[model samples]
Target: MTGTLKLPHEGTPGSSAEGLDARLVVERGAFRLDVTLTAAPGDVVALLGPNGAGKTTALRALAGLVPLTGGHLRLDGAELDRMSPESRPVGVVFQDYLLFPHLSALDNVAFGPRCHGVPKSQARAQAAVWLDRMGLTEHSSAKPRRLSGGQAQRVALARALATRPRLLLLDEPLAALDARTRLDVRAQLRHHLADFEAVALLVTHDPLDAMVLADHLVVVEDGRVVQEGTPSDIARHPRTDYIAHLVGLNLYRGEAEGHSVRLDAGPGITTTEDLTGPVFVAFPPGAVTLHRDRPTGSSARNVWRCEVAGLETHGDQIRADLAGELPLAADLTTVAAAELDLRPGAPVWATVKAAQTHAYPA
Candidate 1:
């Protein structure tokens, strides 16, 4: 422990600068990451995206493990950009629980506090409290290799919290656990995060994790934030095709005029909302209907000759991925699928009512 080790706050209730204020830009070997973010105390923000999207890079920048080419990082109100990882009032739970192989769970949890100058006896006592909170008191003497995946994750979390960080960053925290273990650990982690008054951020590609664990979602792609909002908001109104697909909606970019939109490709679509200029049109796969032949005198204004490119069973329904004038997806029940005799390379007519389509300004 150094004399310069500073506590960001007196207690968890009030935080350093408000919570966290970060605007980061890091350029590395032709890849660039730029993002701006802010969160109040008690807020849990998630950075979600596909592989190589720089979610880990942004997290590394906040932890001072990676240098920023531009922008700044502040937690509570103290500037952390110039500080080293250990000097900042931040704690991280990495994807892999990096507990020392030779150490017991109790010792692993005590190490952080001990390094920060807490007396050995005092740090061990505090470690016990955290282990108890994580339901690992009985396994405190077990080594990392002896613990289960879920147990190891709890110890890592306990160890991080033992240091009393005002900013908690978890990178793929549940990635190592199996499906059943992940569910249990995820539920436990949610409860702990709710009790934490400090700002928390996590990086993950799992939509369920982002939806259940975070209060806000920052969707990143190609080194930039494509969308950011509450989970419900992002689910209901996706701003980009990637997000739309992520939320399971078929999206299209178009120019809107009144109740109709001229799609960038294929035919124009009539929608429920009246909008002008560049716009986005979206609809659910379940809203689409497929017919063997083109029918007339139907209320549906959007119809296209589509060929089924593939079909797969999705729970109780079947998902058909189609390509044609409009590339889209359609969901149908097994009975309907059997009746239509749907298959790959099959010609089908797709129809969607104007009222089923949603249009929003781009």
Candidate 2:
């Protein structure tokens, strides 16, 4: 059980040690997918998208569970497109934590080693080591049915890691947990995943999970990769409406002249940047200030007259959905909203300073 498994074929001396290089294409009845992806060793790349965006399909292709209609898959420089799921040096933890109900936690983790030809005793020994690492030694004899959701998840993780895979695929690792358990499990998962030297790919629609757990993000839409960058980069300047909504920002595409940008929706916004040509204007809801009426002596360059279409509490703040000359979203304190007597159909003026508005080339 402690012996080294055969390493996957290395491409070149300069290539990354434990990453994935793949150009995956899968076609079903009416849907088509084409995505080229790469991840560096120890990089946690999250495939983020809404349902039917092909995130799961891509991950399955990487795991060799789904056959590729075309394109290549290489893990740690070894060709995997032709390998069977069992032959590939990959590990996967499904969302449901598919542990055998009849098996003890110790036996569950030992299954992989036993399948790989190790003796039962040796396999259990290795499994015990992994369980210990996961802080599950005391529960080694517990059956899967008797384990808590988080405990079962850890057992699943330990089972996968015990195999020492070159690539790890996780599908919604924290989705099955309750709100209270999610917070604890999320932190533990982060620590374990960080220690993994192999490439890890996670598929999740939850932005909080993606932002908190992954170092980089790959955003897919309509079966195509629309964007890929670090979490902070995507958060700072989102190019798509889906991404904007994911990162909680209001985005507008427009043409820029000097320090001002003219939106296609018939409004011009001033910005600190002095750029010309096609641009994107983005501002968080918190940057917007709502007023009952246009305030005099206001130096703010960008002001719009709008009517409150709706209001809702978002955490400690109030989100005002407005409709009028230009539809926009603004966030204010609940106290402020109450003081302003903000309500549906209330006339209001929204103001945003040029410095607070960010403009980037579209």
Candidate 3:
């Protein structure tokens, strides 16, 4: 099958600013991936998905590491579809932090400049500047073997940035770091990415990374883009179960008439949206209140009788998985749960206020 993609408007940085534009179609084995992406100068776009979602495949296509079976690739209005990897004005940071073990941190970063024909002195100077910006000046002489995971990641990012490419690509950037180091490095990475004056694309399965680091998000599933929007937009209105769980929201699709919506499972809910026809109703699990018995004088208009099938603790909140006429998930504080004596195999009434139920056209 063939498809057409309309390029989106992009902003320029300085008078000579450049951006990235790609419409790629790549096929391998039984799967074919197609994506059209455009990022303005200094825009950070995250490609989010689970395994086998083609996030990495799309990144590689843009970097010239994977040949596109069809479509076009352009950077700064220059055609790059036929260019080799070295000829493309792009930089990549792989997941493994592929630093040359024989070289020191400074030398590893300088390698890119050296390959581009810069003098050794100039390359090392530029490398030093990038390392210092990453707060790794003290580790300049340390080799990859001697550097910790976080240190190595910083060095990798510095190396990628040293080349001053018009487009940057990163794959699972923070996946290798420990929890403590991940937080620190993520913040530092965001700062440096912000300072960059070109387009940057990151591929990751981590929701927090995408939300915190990127201005826009593209969610890919099964080798296709399922959703694309701002981070807050995707979090607020997820289109699939995978994304609903990712953003910690309970989502339901139903037919709506005025303010009332009937679920496919045989229950009606009151919504605040003045929408009609098919619509989606969504609310966070925390919006649900569970009681052992039927509630009295409760202002909440939507209530359902549910049976607890499982329970689990998610950080400070308790997530109770319920199954009944309408299978749903609810989150509550440990204190509230204790007061309600909630447990597996217990029957309970679930209530949600109409104001809290968000409705949008499906």
Best first by lDDT, ranked: 1, 2, 3
Q: Which segments of model 3 are wrong by more than 4 Å?
A: 1-17
Each model's total of backbone clashes: 4, 0, 0
Tens-digit lDDT string for candidate 3 (188-242): 7887777776788999999999999999999999988899999999998898888
TM-score of model 1 relative to the true fold?
A: 0.93
Scored by lDDT, the top model is 1
TM-score for each prediction?
Answer: 0.93, 0.94, 0.93
Per-candidate RMSD, Å: 4.0, 2.9, 6.0
lDDT of 1 by residue, 46-70 (tens): 9999899999999999999999999
Cα lDDT tens digits, model 2, 214-324, are: 999999998999999999999998999999999989899999999988898868999999999999899999999988879787889999999999999898999999898
lDDT of 3 at 241: 85
Kindly give the stretch of ten consecutive residues in candidate 2 with the minimal lDDT sum: 1-10
Segments in model 2 whose C-alpha atoms lie over 4 Å from true places: 1-18
Record all residue pairs in model 2 with backbone atoms less than 3 Å apart, i.e. clashing: none
What ranking of all candidate models by TM-score puts the best one first? 2, 1, 3
